[model samples]
Target: MTATSSPPAAASRLDHLGLLYRDAEEYAERCAAFLADGLAAGDPALVAVPGANGDLIRDRLGTGRAEVRFADMAVAGRNPGRIIPGVLLAFAAAHPGRRVRIIGEPIWPGRTGLEYPACAMHEALINVALARHDAIVLCPYDAARLPSDMVEDAWRTHPVMLDGAGRRASPAYGDPVATAADFDVPLPLPPAGAARLVFEGFPDLPGVRAFVAGWADAAGLPSVRRPDVLLAVNELATNTADYTGGPGTLLLWREDAVMVCQIDDQGHLDDPLAGRVPPADSVGRGRGVLVVNELADLVRIHRRPGGTSIRLHFDLGIPPPS
Candidate 1:
């Protein structure tokens, strides 16, 4: 399958080191130029959000991109209906007859915290667009910030979003875990039909939560149980990043009456997230890990080069593996 190609032949223009500064016209002209280049090179057209370093590119091609870049421009809020439809409509209209060739902007620059949903919107939009065009969607985002459902959906559906550097949010920022998380251990072999959702290069937290929530919902888990998995995965995956210096791959599946999730990164751990449970803390210390261990019937750990894999098996219906 195209998704499984080893040593992909094409050099990804998605790296988009093309971040530049200029007026909208200049940006549109540059964008048009990129589109022309893509057209000549048989590449996808680049879609620019208001501020995604797309200034020069968009100025070169597009007459003028819209300012309604994201649904939620505020740094502390949640709103999707505000921005997604417009972008989707733009996509639908732009490629009316041609293939949906697009270079996506999952995050808008000069913005606060709207890139995440925007990324998800781009993801869903691209999936639909692909049905009509030979699409290549490249979205770089903070995996942790993704909406829980979208994250899960991305894992099951969209192609992998890779690790790339963005701003490390302020330490005072709403971080779910801490420095300790960058070192959790990886666990045993995962059940079949599970794969990886790498999160270390994450610039957003909402998306990751979304992925976790989605995973829980799909795995037949209740709402309360969902947070437990979400927190655990966050802590563990963060630990993976601290140790490996990159996002870890997540493997999810079902073993009997349980939904199993294993995280693999370039770290090693002797003491896993299970065993002796810790007491409730005043500030919620070790709670996430403890909850994860408590919820699952089987919590296994494994170690690999530069990383570790921790697997949490949540009950669903089938009996434990004999």
Candidate 2:
């Protein structure tokens, strides 16, 4: 299928497209067509997919494919929560005024059950996050490899659907905020040997970091990853202190092959897109959550009427470099 030659009429709106392809060959062909259209239109373009897919597209695009910024989604989008700020919005924000086109494949056959909810939410929230941007984002789904339900969810998340048959508006499109709210399952309790801490005030930031590092070390988290875990914890704790004006509780534990950290505060995060999009200015409040999402292998948030709880996960098997 060929992509539209030009971006949609509304320069301030986001046009989210979902593509369902049956195989590698089909994916490569459709993606190449879509991205080629974007490149030919002189729009800033980006492709963030798994390494093999990136290679396939590059091979098809041939020389000068290097001009298209390419990122390995396996690494950049390891935590789906980070895709909006670290990948999508980062690209759009860099090229203000000009329309941008991106091919992002965040969901794949390899996504674990634990990671699916966050991935789904990320997909849904993309609509809300980029609502006012002049961007066209194409998200690809491996139809033969992924579950039917996942494909259905894609229809709900995206406003436009593209396949071999071409593009059309998705009748299944729903409010992204409501879609995100549907996945707000309660997080599990910390493990048996979990460590707990409570801190208040900006002065306690250091204490929070220290506490996280200490527990990370005890949990056998590699030295290299300890810093990331600490930074994520510090970001969460800082948000708690700054926004809630009260003490926040933190729990750390090693469950199976993952190290988990949960931060709780008396604050409700109403914006589903908070950490997913970068702040327009340096002083933006959601930057901390953005940092936390980037550092953690997986991050889950539960925000209710009374409070918010964010859980950060680091895989024990993926040790940091020496």
Candidate 3:
């Protein structure tokens, strides 16, 4: 990859670059070099990637590892919707006036089709969220292993692309908002065996939780993650009661490795950035959806003219088919 030019150090904007690496060696070398350059310049550097990849980068960094912060992307970015508020921006906020450098690989070869949309949307939204911050986020994609369409999507989401040929401006870069909406297509209907419940208003929240907890238990969801599933669904139900002013429907089912909890209501979410952005204040309102995003393994939303449907996925620790 070429030593690409970044925005001026004084500029208050994010330099979002997509790194298309062919193998693990290239991925580590490129990422470690980027972090090393930032450390040389006294910038706060962070590496958030899967454990095995982190190890590779750490090895490449060697003694320099001490200067770079590390986070397990598998845990922190399990829900792509949470990466913005919980990982990227949170790290930026911790350092007030300094320009931050981050290597965020939210999408990996292991990412499933069920989780790809959320991952794609998160990458696109990074442009919007860090537009005015003096930060550089380098996202790496495994071009050899990932789907060709996903590799194609890297161009749409990032303004800069780096690979064997070197860095270049992405003429295919599209509007961030439009890219997000393109993935908001309607979800498939729940299968016949899926369990469901209809809720009226706030008064029925307790029952909603019980219904979810019971179904999740029956589906053999790990006991440790049961509360997370319950809390996420309860938040969605509460939002329906508080905002929709109409009854809502809840669907529960198990699809191989994921337990799905979907909520449908007569609510319109015009803000594509909702739940993705942190609330204004710590003690203020509007944290329900944010909390849901932080807890679920994956989240998908389908908003229509008259209503919105939000589906949260909880991984059941089952390995995907090879």
What are the lDDT scores of the predictions, listed in order? 0.43, 0.84, 0.87
- Across 1-322, the per-residue lDDT of candidate 1 in tens digits comes to 0001122234322221222222445444434554565566554354534343454454444433342122222211112222222343355355665443344444433322322332333343333323333444443332344344433434332334332232222222111112112222333345566744656655634556677777666666756556656776676665554444656677667655657678766654533212222333465333444444445544544445655556665555545445
Ranking by TM-score: 3, 2, 1
Q: Which stretches of candidate 1 lie over 4 Å from their true place?
A: 1-188, 202-204, 242-244, 270-288, 317-322
Give the distance in Å from residue 87's predicted Cα in candidate 1 to where it truly belongs. 54
Regions of candidate 3 where Cα sits further than 4 Å from its true position:
1-12, 318-322
Model 2 misplaced regions, further than 4 Å: 1-12, 202-206, 282-284, 317-322
Task: Judging by TM-score, tell me the better candidate of 1 and 3.
Answer: 3
Q: Report the candidate with higher lDDT, 1 versus 2.
A: 2
Per lDDT, what order, best first? 3, 2, 1
lDDT string for model 3 (85-194, tens) is 99999999999999999999999988878788889988988888787788999999999999999999999999999999999999999888889778787887889999
TM-score of 2: 0.88
Task: Score residue 215 of candidate 1 by CA lDDT.
Answer: 62
